[model samples]
Target: MTGSTNIMIRKLIRSLEKQKKPLWKTVAEKLQTPSRKRWYINLYKIEKYTKPGDIVIVPGKVLGIGNLTHEVTVVALDFSKSAKEKILKAGGKVMSLYDFDKLDLKGKNVRLMKQ
Candidate 1:
């Protein structure tokens, strides 16, 4: 990982330890690998695999090559401008892993979306 991505992974790990969210820890582990191995989920794939109101964590960035018809919570290291806009337009929530980890959302229904 590069400096920025390394920092993000550290933050995710720290947050996982503090928040006691096992899922984030797993995602952080996945993110620590080579960049080519990291996830980069597209909106269309997420739309197909997830349902409305689901919480999703992408181990890398989110691309905007597709559209999302359902509102869902998306937590990731980065997002394309169009992806963020589309998620918001669909009444979804976009949160950074660092921010999402600070929330009192332990045990909620969350899934890791990787590509």
Candidate 2:
């Protein structure tokens, strides 16, 4: 991550700390790791693990190595261009981890998929 991204994630960590959300706090911690060591999840894995309407949070980038057949919400630190397109084409939504802070989630059907 860049210097600015590190700063931003620190702020996010503090925010999640205050909110006391264990799930998002975990995500923030994963985000703090070196970029090279972060998770790289593909569409097929997501499709296999999640059902339609599921919210999947990935701590690293989303790669477009496979196909997705269901509509799901995916939040990640980054996404490949093809990954974004594939997710959208499959009627799914993609979002950045930064954008995740402002989202109001009901906490149901939310998953953390990482290796």
Choose the strongest candidate by TM-score.
2
Cα displacement (angstroms), candidate 1, residue 44, comes to 0.4
- Whole-model alpha-carbon lDDT for candidate 1: 0.79
Candidate 2 — worst ten consecutive residues by lDDT sum?
Answer: 1-10
Question: With candidate 1 superimposed using the best TM-score fit, by how many Å does residue 43's alpha carbon deviate from the native?
Answer: 0.2
Enumerate residue pairs that collide in model 2.
none
For model 1, the run of ten residues with the poorest summed lDDT: 101-110
Query: Per-residue alpha-carbon lDDT of model 1 for 31-111, expressed as tens digits?
Result: 667777778889998889888888888878999988899899998888999999999998999998767735455454677
Q: What lDDT does model 2 reach?
A: 0.85
TM-scores for every predicted model: 0.81, 0.87
Candidate 2 per-residue C-alpha lDDT over 5-101 given as tens digits, one digit per residue, 9 for 90 to 100: 5677677656665666788778867877776788999988998999999999998899999999989999988899999999999999999887777
